[model samples]
Target: MIAIIDYGAGNLFSVKNALTYLGLPYQITNDLEEIRRADSYILPGVGAFPFAMKMLRQTNLIEEIKKQVVEKPLLGICLGMQMLFEESYEFERCSGLSLIPGKVDRWDAGGLKIPHMGWNQLSVKQPENPLLKGLQEGDSVYFVHSYMAYPKPEHLAAFCEYGVQVPALVSKGNVYGAQFHPEKSGEVGLQILRNFGGLTK
Candidate 1:
C-alpha cells in the first residue's frame, strides 16, 4: 500500500483524491510502524519550508522517512520536494531532509510576478527517470511557488522557465519530486502521479 504521510502539514485531500481517481490504495498517517512497512510513500505538502520542517520534526517522522526512502519508492510534491533537499534559502536558511543533494533558492523574478502561478511547460532534462516515464518535453503543468530547487543537473529530471529555469521535476534513486502540484495540474499532473505510483525499487 502507498503511504501518504500525514505530518500535519500535507495538503492531503487533493492528493488523496488523485490517488483514488487512479485506483491506488493509500493510507494517510504519521504512525511510524505503518510508514516503515508501506510499499510506497508520498510526501505531499503546501506550506513554508521552515514551518514544514518544524512539523515533520515535531511528528518525529524525519528518521522514519529517511529509512523508508532508502528501501521503497518515495515521492515528494511541492513543499515536500523542497524538504527533501539539503537546505532551502526560503524565509530563513533552514535545513531540509538532506535526502537529495541540492538547495532551494528564490526565483529571480526578473520583472515577472512572484509565486509564478498558472501553467508552464516542462523543459525535460533527464527524461529517462521513471517518474517521468510517459511524459514528453514541453508538456505543460501547473506551478505555484516563489522558490525552486537548484540540485545537481543530473538530479533534475525537468525544468520550467519563468524568470529563470526552475527545477520542476527531480529524482534521486528511489526519491522523486514534482515542484508543481501533480494533484492539481489537470491530466498532465495526474499522469505524473500515475508515473510515480508505478515506480518500483
Candidate 2:
C-alpha cells in the first residue's frame, strides 16, 4: 500500500482520487506506524511553506518521513515538494526536509505574472530517469505556483519555461518531486502517476 501522508495541509482528496482512478492501493493518514508500513509515500500539499512545515512538525512526521524515504520511494507535490529542499523564502527563512540539495524562492518571472498558472510543456532534462519513463516528447503538465526550486542540474529530471525555466520534476535516489499537480494535469498527469506507481516494482 502507498501512504498518502495527511499532515493537515495537503490537497489530499484530489491526490487520493487520482490514485484511486489509477487503481493504486493507498491510505491517507498521519499515523507514524502506517507510514512506516507503506511501500511508497505521497506528500501532497497546498499552502505556504512556513505553515506546512509547522504542521509537519506539529504532527511529528518529519523524522519518520526522513527515515522512511531512505528505504522507500517518496513523491512530494507542489508545496510538499518545496518542503523537500534545504530552505524556503516564502514567509521567512525556514528550514525544509533537506532531502534534495536546493532552496525555494520566488522566481523573477521576467515580469510576466506573479503566479505562473496553467498548462506548460515539460522539457525533459534527464530522459533516462525512471519517473519519466513513458513521457512523450512534448508532454505537458499543469502548474500553479509562485515560488520555485533552484536545484542542481543533475537532480532536475524535467522543466518547463514560463517567464523563466521552472523546475517541473526533480529526482534523487528514491525521492521525486513535482512542482505541478499531476493529479489535475489530464492524461499527461495520469501517465506521470502511472510511472510513479511503476517505481515500486
Candidate 3:
C-alpha cells in the first residue's frame, strides 16, 4: 500500500483519484504508524512552504518522515518535494528533511513570472533514473509554483527550462522529489507515479 501523507495541504483529491484510477491501493492518513507500515510513502502538498513545515512539526511527523526517507522509497510532490531539501526561504526561515543538500527559494530573477504556471517540458539530466524511466528529454509536465529547489548538481535528476533551468526533479538515494504536480501531468505524470509504485521492495 502507498501512503499519501495528509497534513492539511491542498489538491489531495486529484492525487487520490489518480492513484485509484491506476488501480493502485493507497491510504491517505497523518498517522505515523500507518505511514511507517506502508510499502511506499508519497508526500503531496500545495501551499506556502513555511506553513506546511509548521503543520508537519505540529503533527510530529517531521522526524518520522526523516526515518521513512532513510528506510524506504519516499516520493515528494510539489511543496512536499521542496521540503525534502535542507532549507527554504519562503515566508521565514524553515528547515527541511535535509536528505539533499540544497535550498528552496523564490524566483526573484527579472522578466520571468514569479509563479511558473502551466505545462513545461522536462530536460532529463540522469537518463538512468527510475523515476524518469520511459520519459524523454522534452516530456511536458504540469507545474504551479512560485518557488523552486536548487540542489547541488549531483543531486539533480531532471530539470525544466523557464527563464532559467529550474530543478524539475531531484533524488538522493531512495528519496525523490518532483517540483511539478505529477498527479496532474496526464499520462507522463501517471507513468512516473506508476514507476514509483513499482519500486516497492
Candidate 4:
C-alpha cells in the first residue's frame, strides 16, 4: 500500500480518489508509524513551497521520508515534485527535500504565459526508466504551474515543450517525481498511476 502523506497542504482527496478509481490500496496519513509501515509513499501538493514545507515540517515527516525513500519508491506530484529538489524559488529561496540534484525556479517561457496550463506532449528522454513503462514520446499530460525544476539530465525521464523544455517526469534510484497531476490527466494519467502502482512491493 502507498501512504498518501497528509501534510495539510496536499490535494489529498483528489489523489485518494484517483488511487481508489484504480483500485490501488492507499491510506492518507500524517502518522509517522503508519508511514514507516507502508510499502511506498505519494507526496501530493497544491500550494506554495514555503507554506507546504512548513506544514510538512510541522507533521514531523521530513526525516522519516528522507530515511524511507532510500529503500522504497516515492512519487511526488506537481508542487510535491518541486519539493523533491534541493531548493526552490517559488516565493523565496527555500530548501527542499534534496532527493534530486536540482532547483525549482520560475519558468522563462520565452514570452509565453506564466502558468503553462492545459495539455502538453511529453518527450521521452530516458526510455528505459521503469516509471515511464508504457509511456512514449508525445504522450500528453496536464500541467498547471508557474515554476519548474531543472533536474540533472540523467534524472530527467521525460519533458514537454511549452516554449521551453519543461521537466514532465523524473526519476533517480527509488525516487520519482511528476510535474503534472496524473489524477487530472485522463487515461494517460491512469496509465501513469498504474505504472507507479506496479513499482510498490
- For each candidate, how many residue pairs have backbone atoms clashing (under 3 Å)? 0, 0, 0, 0
Supply the global lDDT for candidate 1. Answer: 0.88
- Model 4, position 27: C-alpha lDDT score: 97
- Residues 60-173 of candidate 3 have per-residue lDDT tens digits of 887887787776888899999998999999988799878889999977546877689999999988999999988888999999999989999998999988888999999999
Question: Highest lDDT, which number?
Answer: 4
Which sequence of candidate numbers ranks them by lDDT, best first? 4, 2, 3, 1
* Model 2 misplaced stretches (Cα beyond 4 Å): none
TM-score of each: 0.96, 0.98, 0.96, 0.98
Q: On residues 24-91, what C-alpha lDDT tens digit does candidate 4 reach at each position? A: 99999999899999999999998899999999999989999999999999999999999999999987
Assess each prediction's global lDDT (C-alpha) against the native. Answer: 0.88, 0.91, 0.89, 0.92
Model 4 poorest ten-residue lDDT run:
128-137
**lDDT score for residue 138 of model 1:** 84
Candidate 3: residue 80 Cα off by (Å):
0.6
Tens-digit lDDT string for candidate 1 (1-67): 8999998889999999999999988999899888887889999888799988998899888887888
